[model samples]
Each structure stands twice: as structure tokens, then as C-alpha cells.
Target: TIEMKADKTLSSVLSARAFNALMMVDFWNPIYSWRRAVLMQYVPGTASFDPESSRYDLEDAFITNVKKSGLYTQGDRESLEIQFISLLEVELEQHQKRIQAYLNHARDRLKTSEGLLGCLTLAESRR
Candidate 1:
């Protein structure tokens, strides 16, 4: 019960942080576009841009857009993109591991509770 209540607060905090991060990344960034592409890969035909396109194509579009807005160079783009994607992948992997661990813990707790309930039922039958 306490965990559920805490999760409500945690959910709000996480949603806000996620939204902030999404804004910070900006829609033009290839990383953001690539993330969306990867997430939506399983869906049917899309109304917007095709998600099956190469990440390099996405990066080129990002570079072209950025160049239109400001002075970004071709050389720095690769280095910066490599760093951003690598760091993002590492963070995502860590979150996945944490989620898996939490699920395993919850499953063990459920099994323990079920075993206890079974024991109680057996005792009631003996009476």
C-alpha cells in the first residue's frame, strides 16, 4: 500500500523529468527521432515520416535542420552524436536492469504470500 502511494508521487516526478528531458533533446535531434523510430517499429504504416529509414538519414536531416538554424559543422556532428547515443544507450540499459530486478523481487514476494495463504487454508481444513 505504501509502495503504491509512493509510486503515485514517483510517477508524477518521473513524468515531469521525462518531459523536460524530451524538450531538452529537441525534436530535430537525430537521437530523439531515432528513439521514436525504434519504439514505433512494430506499428503499422505511419502517417508521418517512415520509421524504417536509416539512422544516418535521420542524422543528415538533423544536421541540415541545425545548419538552417545555426552554425553547426559536419565534423563535430559525428563526434557529438556518437557520444550522445552511447550515453543514452548506457542509461537505458541501466534502467532496464533496475526494472527487471524490481519485477523479480515483486514475483518472489507474490510467491511467498501465496504460500502463506495455502498454509492458512490447509490449517483451516484440518480444523
Candidate 2:
């Protein structure tokens, strides 16, 4: 009969709750989100870019920081513009829809206020 012997060591490490706490910060103002359409739609007229610098500097600041970090790179200037154009298009479309809705609401409010003012003016004239 041949005798066989084996030796082995096993270990395991598990971390169910190990975590790091981080504060979430958003650098954009709520009001700027509404007006960003104007900024994003164009790269601007006073841009300074050449062998000294690159074009993305002037236009890139307006993109939300998250998107800027995700989509931007030193080499992808044209791609950045294309992506900005698409994002700007979407933002502008949504802005237009919101503006239309606001205009409609304003029209309704104006009509109601005018009617009330007319009623008050007529009532005053009767006195």
C-alpha cells in the first residue's frame, strides 16, 4: 500500500460594509440651466485658438461638468463640438417647449387679469 499525504492552507477575506463617504457637489446654478442654450449653441466670436492654444477652452466651460469630464479630451476637439451641438440642440428644443408653455400660461394669466381689471374699472366708472 502506498501512503499519500497532502497539506493545504485556505483563507478568505470579505468586506460587506467597507466604504468611503464623498460629498456630491454640483457647480451649476439652477437658473443657468435655463439660459445655457444660448451659450452652448455656438463656440462664440472672440475665440482664441491656434498652435498657442486650442478651441475648446472658450466653449467648453458651459457644458455641465459631468458631461465635460466624460466627453472631452485633448485630442477630440471636433468630436467635442459635435457632441456639444447635439446636446445644445436637445437643450434648445426643451427650452423652446418650456418657453411655449410659459407663453401660453402667461397669455391665460393676462387675459384673466385684463378681464378682472376691466370689471373693476367699469365698476369704478359706475360710481
Candidate 3:
């Protein structure tokens, strides 16, 4: 979890329109479907994610510590993969809902505004 400063803007706290534009362009625009994650894992293994120092690597703690304990039985990787996929699907669905609501609000704003593009139709002469 990358903690922002206490005075972070609302847009910073939540997802912004720029993120939506990128999602539309890069990943193929999604309407009813939820967005997909870049990786099935929490973080890809490498220098990018250091379990020793990063505050966000808590997911692997169970596999590393709890699984390593002598008293505990080893987990089934296939079952764990199934559960992780289910959990991620739910998370992405919620994110999709939020982005949809945000886009709706933006469209409403544009519709109500007196800006040039706000007019219902463009005249051929004006072009």
C-alpha cells in the first residue's frame, strides 16, 4: 500500500479519468465486463517487488511464514490458484462499477455545460 500524504486530492485517492482513457485505449474498452489484472499474482517476482522491504507484499506472508512452520500442512497450489482467481474477479468487478459511475458523472457534466461540444449537434457550416 503506497500511502499518499494526508492532503491528497480526491482524484488521487480514487481512480481518475486519465486511467479510464488508458484502459479504453490499451486494454480494449470494457462496458459490461470487469477489468483484468496485469498479473495473476499480487506482484511479479523480481527487483520490482522486494518481499523483505515492501509494505505491500503481505499476501505472500501466508505462503512464506505459515506454510514454512513445522506444524502446518502444505497447501495445494491448484486450490490456492482457484481461490485467488475468484477473489481477483470480485475486486475487478467493483473497480469496473466505480469507473462506470465516474464516467457517467463526467458525461452528465459535459451535457449540462455551455461548452462548444455541449451543443446537441454540430452544424456543417460551423465545421
Per residue, candidate 2 scores C-alpha lDDT tens digits across 77-122 of 5443334434444444454565578667756755787866875786
C-alpha RMSD by candidate, in order? 18.6, 23.4, 15.5
Q: What is the lDDT of residue 68 in candidate 2?
A: 41
**Winning candidate number (TM-score):** 2
Clashes of 3: 0
Give TM per candidate.
0.23, 0.29, 0.24
Candidate 1 at residue 5, lDDT?
A: 31
- 14-51: candidate 1 lDDT, tens digit per residue: 23333333323333343445544432222223122223
Off by over 4 Å in 2: 1-47, 51-56, 62-91, 114-127
Name the runs in model 1 displaced over 4 angstroms: 1-90, 114-127
Per-residue lDDT of 9 in model 2: 12
Error of 3 at 117 (Å): 9.9
* Model 1 error, position 10 (Å): 21
Runs of candidate 3 with Cα error greater than 4 angstroms are: 1-90, 114-127
* Decreasing lDDT order of the candidates: 3, 1, 2
Q: Tell me the tens digit of each residue's lDDT in model 3 across 7-115.
A: 5444532234323322432232343223324222323242123436432333344234333443333345434333333333344566577667877775775766463
Q: Against the unseen true structure, what C-alpha lDDT does each candidate score?
A: 0.39, 0.36, 0.40
Candidate 1 local lDDT, residue 85? 31
